[model samples]
Target: MSYELRDHTADVAVEATADTLAALFAAVAEGLTAASAQSVPATPGDRFEVEVAAESREALLFDYLDRLIYERDVRLVLPADHRCTVAEPSETDRTDESDDPDAWRLAASARGVPLDAVAAREIKAVTYSEMALERRGDGWRAYVVFDV
Candidate 1:
């Protein structure tokens, strides 16, 4: 997995690539954390779990990143390590394209440190203004902009 910081007019952006959907999500999560703080703790002091569902792959990525931002803002935690899994919609769950109960489901955990422990930059929110997720030659790539 890999990510690169991109230039955005007034926000922070990240482009992440990975061999699998789950790994792509994890890379983006790590990128968000990296954008927020100068450096993460050598080891995580705590862990938090997250579960989110969306009607499409793009929306799922958007929600996943937004959830991480929400966790940081509300709980005063800095995500340091990440583990995530993406489940494809089951046959029964794929009724309509937009109303599927399991169109995309993400199960993730963020290992973090207390906010006060590290110097951080405020990432106000995650935005859909410039968000995308798509399959590439051999893997997947996602781009996200953070409202700073």
Candidate 2:
């Protein structure tokens, strides 16, 4: 239903839940805002198209956030609403792509922050070392950490 934020040693902890994997990923975006409050806005503005590929749902979640961290490091992106469509790799697949990923990428716009603009937060990275995505009953749940 909603993303929850928690305190960590040198970063922030995030969690979200949904009825499906796609929804769960979307919730994680909201959780990011809570973690990067210094650079993120209290109000949302624009939503961008973001596409990512990975081997598993957990990996997918990690890759997605790590990509965001990359953008953040590059000063091109900040935390905001994200709508993700997740799919697993096929058994016979060699090269990895999330559903022909080139066409499945997403674009998000932040309400309070601007990419490549001025920011004061020091969120260094989003790590997959602790990321998790699992189905509990009829809903999906996930957790991730951001290096601040």
Candidate 3:
């Protein structure tokens, strides 16, 4: 796994890569976690049930990252790991579910400082502007450019 910081006008963007789709998503989520908090310690808690199936892994990656970003912005709930149900892509993308996200279980007693407490790096949005999710000879890789 690898992560790099890129300059943005308003918010910081993270560029990360991994050998598997799961790993790539993990790294991407970790990027958001790092951006939102100072550090990560052991988070003890029930598993949260989150199922997001995109039309493609590329779409899946973006939705996952954006969802995490929304959590960071709204609830300050930074997920340690997303137990995603990686499914086959659908023909039409689904970005909305008329339900509450917090309805999901809190998988752990994770520690996270309030947004104001942290040295907030403004991330305007998670961008697909330069997003890429693909398969290599080894496995899968992804890239996302967050808006500042």
Candidate 4:
């Protein structure tokens, strides 16, 4: 899994590619964290779980990054070390009467350090502009732009 920071007209952007959907998400999430922090602590401080469901893969990526921003602000930390799993709705979801039976789901665990402990920057929000998630050959790629 790898991610690259891209130049945007007036914002920051990231493009990540991985061999699996889960790794793709993890890479993009790491991009978001990299964009937000100048330096993150080497030792873990706080660990958190993030769960997000969306009707589409694009939306799932957006919501997942947005939720990380929310978690960072609320927890006063810079999140990192993302491990994620992305899946389509399963039979159990239908049996459980999920609100959106076709929604894609992402479950992730991450570690973070206090925001004040690092040199951090502000990312106002994750925007849908130029956002993309698609399979390329046998791998997946995701691109996202952040509103600064």
| Sequence-dependent TM-score of model 4 | 0.94
* Candidates 2 and 4, the one with greater lDDT: 4
**Model 4 misplaced regions, further than 4 Å:** none
Candidate 2, poorest ten consecutive residues by summed lDDT: 101-110
- For model 1, what is the C-alpha lDDT against the true structure? 0.87
Q: What would the C-alpha RMSD of candidate 1 be, to one decimal place? A: 3.0
Pick by lDDT: which candidate is best?
Answer: 4
Better of 1 and 4 by TM-score: 4
Runs of candidate 1 exceeding 4 Å displacement: 92-100
Best candidate, TM-score-wise?
4
Model 3 clash number: 7
Model 3 C-alpha RMSD vs. true structure (Å) is 6.6
lDDT tens per residue, model 2, 1-148: 6788878777788888899777787788778765765544444345445567655566677777777666655545565756667655544433564345332233333333565443456567778657777899999888888887
Clashing pairs in 3: 11-122, 11-148, 44-108, 44-109, 45-107, 45-108, 46-107
Q: Which is better, 1 or 2, measured by lDDT?
A: 1
Stretches of candidate 2 exceeding 4 Å from the true structure: 38-47, 90-112, 115-120
